[model samples]
Target: MAGPSRFVVHVPFTAPDRAEARQYARMLARVLGRLPEVDPAEATVSPEDDQSVHSRLFCDRLLSGGHRCALRAEHEAPCAVVESDR
Candidate 1:
């Protein structure tokens, strides 16, 4: 078995405000979350700083392992891995 699969995908970006950041994040998630590898319900977006927002997308290998790897390979920003439940 592949084991329990989960990842906290961090996508960084700058936005004018929380609303805009959320809009942009949602837009990005709309595309990324829609991918077979992503669980949209578990996806979340939050501001890391005044200039950047972080998008966390959880994934399961059974759903889209290939797609997730492809994204990780192509992503410009370094992704953050959630280490624990808390």
Candidate 2:
């Protein structure tokens, strides 16, 4: 068995406000959550600072061992940033 799969996804951005940040984080989850092999609920992103956040995605045996490498890279794709004017 390949065991559990872990991938570190980095979400980088400066949110305009708390609401925007929460929405953005939720957006990130929705995208990655669509992946069938991984439990989207387990995937999360926490702000590292004003400029960035780190996302951790979890997958069980459903994910091929090689798939873990792609998780982070795939999540990093260009995503539109939503922020409040404030």
- lDDT of all predictions: 0.53, 0.49
> Candidate 1, residues 5-30: lDDT per residue as tens digits?
78877778889986677667656755
lDDT of 2 by residue, 1-86 (tens): 79777875665667886557656766676565566654454555565653355444322122343233323323555332222222
Q: How well does candidate 1 match the true structure in TM-score terms?
A: 0.50
Clashes of each: 0, 0
TM-score of each: 0.50, 0.44
Which consecutive 10 residues in model 2 have the weakest lDDT in total? 58-67
Candidate 2 regions off by >4 Å? 50-86
After aligning candidate 1 to the native by TM-score, how far in Å is the CA of 1 from where it should be?
4.4
Residue ranges of candidate 1 with Cα displaced over 4 Å: 1-3, 50-86
Alpha carbon deviation, residue 63, candidate 1 (Å): 22
